[model samples]
Target: MVSLPSTLERIRTRLILLALFLMPWQTRWIFGTDTLSGGISEFGVLSFFVVEGLIVLAFVLQPFIEHHRDFDGAVTLGWVMMLAMLASVFSASNPHLAMMAWLHVLGAYVLFLNLLNRHVKPKEALFAFTLGLVAPALLGVFQAVTGSSPASTLLGLASHDAMTAGASVIETFSMRWLRAYGSFQHPNVFGGYLAVGLFAVFLFLRWDVSKKARMGAYAVGALLTATLVLTYSRSAWIAFVLSSVLAGWLLFLHHRVELRRVIPLGLIILFVMGFTATLFSNPYVVALEETHPGREVYAYQPVHNLYLLMLSELGVIGTLFVLLWMVLIDRYIFANLPRVGAVGALAIGSALFIIGFFDHYLWSLWPGLALVAFVLAMTLRLSEPGVEKE
Candidate 1:
């Protein structure tokens, strides 16, 4: 039987879930015109703040709702180092942005601790969290097909003015028309976003969800993947491939359950490969000046830029620390908390890491920072006993 506090905690948890799922819309300023940052969209502004508030609420209620804690000292240390590095490395780019990013990380950690401690059930968390991504995935497809129509207009296509502007931009000069960036600033970011969504939906399919839920997940995943390809973002393409491989590997891990699953997935992959080969031969892919710009001058931009992004914005020394920090976090969680949910979170983190290869999520202070924090908190909380995970 649930106590009054526990019942209230559940309500709070539900509200927090609603807040998170609403972040993209609010940040994007979808339904409303007013925002916290003057006329600027509220969606972007709320993404970090809403998630942060939820974290605080969770932490405050943790003791009341949870009976135990599963945070490993090693993981905690890594997280601390990660936070410190972000503050130092990103200071040069924009100190305020850097600090905000760090704060998001901190907030996520608090949220993670609370979740692991038992503020929310695993199924509730998964459904609520995945719903957030799913909405954006659908929106992205809608936006892309129609050409990023005005924030208000859902269909038709983006205004001719916006498309012209997008085509004129130097960074995306090669793009023929506007692509759906959804609430994000760039097509690449949207692609990365969809990649993570694909993973979540794919994972759901493998879980004990109803046939309808599983089928819906598969459809959403496929739609997101197809829309991502339409973005024509090379980075998103790489992320998708890596995400697909990871999901396939995870699905195959329980090989004896269904050999039929692996067989069809394999064939589909082969077909995709052939299709990709044909597409690469198209003059469009070959026409680009450089797949990744500015790399030719330094040749170092590939590795050095990422390192600089981590160090200069986070600090030189701090960037180096992340390797140890993440490893420690992985080891501690895997060693003491062997739940499937924890494993799934780690896998998702890995998918994001791959996504980071092309985009600089670590460079911002909102969604990226919040995402990392949420991942850590989920891992820690799911490790605790009495929690049904993944």
Candidate 2:
């Protein structure tokens, strides 16, 4: 008869092999060449809430709740915060529309939390997460190099989807295409996703158990950096630099590494100079000046007003509540880094912080917000003691 230890070993081996089989990440979805049928069949078709429902049931039915009981309070608190924001939207003019929008946000977060907890371990989460971005990263590279857009045939995403169309292509000295948006609906979203994934890879390089694995982790990190640059997202560009500094500082307290000192400073200088240049060099800057007297009209009104939008939608009190949550997360991670392992959690937190700047990422109305929520949940869970099971 096989002993319990031997039985566990067999299961572990099978799980590792299964993860390896799914490493490429691009195989999960199909892309297409045109809009209409392709978009309708792919993007317009599936209900992400259906996916959330199944996972919620699975979590509810777990026989030994004690195994995951530590996280129950945190998770419950997060849900309450989200529900409160939804209630505010319901108080708006259009009740039906507000409810629909709120449901989308809630459903996305639930799906993210559920999928992450059910499917990913701390070690495998990075790999599984990387697999999610691999296809988009590769396609984004191809798009950058060739200036060929992925055919809008299958995944149902197109160049004109509010996020991708006008701002997708950025003119550069090297004749660069717009940053590769990949599977995301827009370049900014793609930039946000790529930036987050690359940071995870960077953290993995620092914390991975095996020497051989570090090489692969670093390679993925480099690829993600390249993808982030090519996407030409100025907001993302700024966020990456800021988050890297914050992440390095957090991780340095725990690990005391040399490269962390060098890399963040270099990135800060590079991104600051480049982003400054882009702002001045773009002809659109001149066009905006011509159309609107004050630069604030172009800069602060629509694009740079994410915080103002938050205040408008959630009101002053609600906005403060959300901002306080951000502060709490930072304090929690800082306090718990030694017990929880700071590398990946720090990187994930930094990436999300950066993503939140230009986009209303914390709001959770968009589908990509689900991906961000998943990263946050995974980071929080990994940071918690005794969360990972054998």
Model 2 lDDT per residue over 10-42, tens place? 454334324322322212232222233334423
Candidate 2 vs. true structure, TM-score: 0.69
Candidate 1 lDDT over 1-390, as tens digits, reads 889876767766776676456544424222223233345532233234544665577556544445343355644665667666655745444454345446666665565555554556656665666677665666655665455445443321233323555431213344444455655556665666565565555445445667677556655655665556655666656766665565446545644353353344345444544553454223324434445544442122354233446655555567667767667557655664334545455566666666565556634535655555555555554444544433
lDDT of 1 at 384: 45
TM-score of each model, in listed order: 0.71, 0.69
Cand. 2 Cα-lDDT? 0.55
Q: Which model scores highest in lDDT?
A: 2
Error of 1 at 78 (Å): 5.7
* Model 2 spans with C-alpha error above 4 angstroms: 1-70, 115-119, 159-167, 171-176, 209-212, 257-305, 316-328, 338-340, 361-365, 386-390
lDDT of each: 0.53, 0.55
lDDT of 1: 0.53
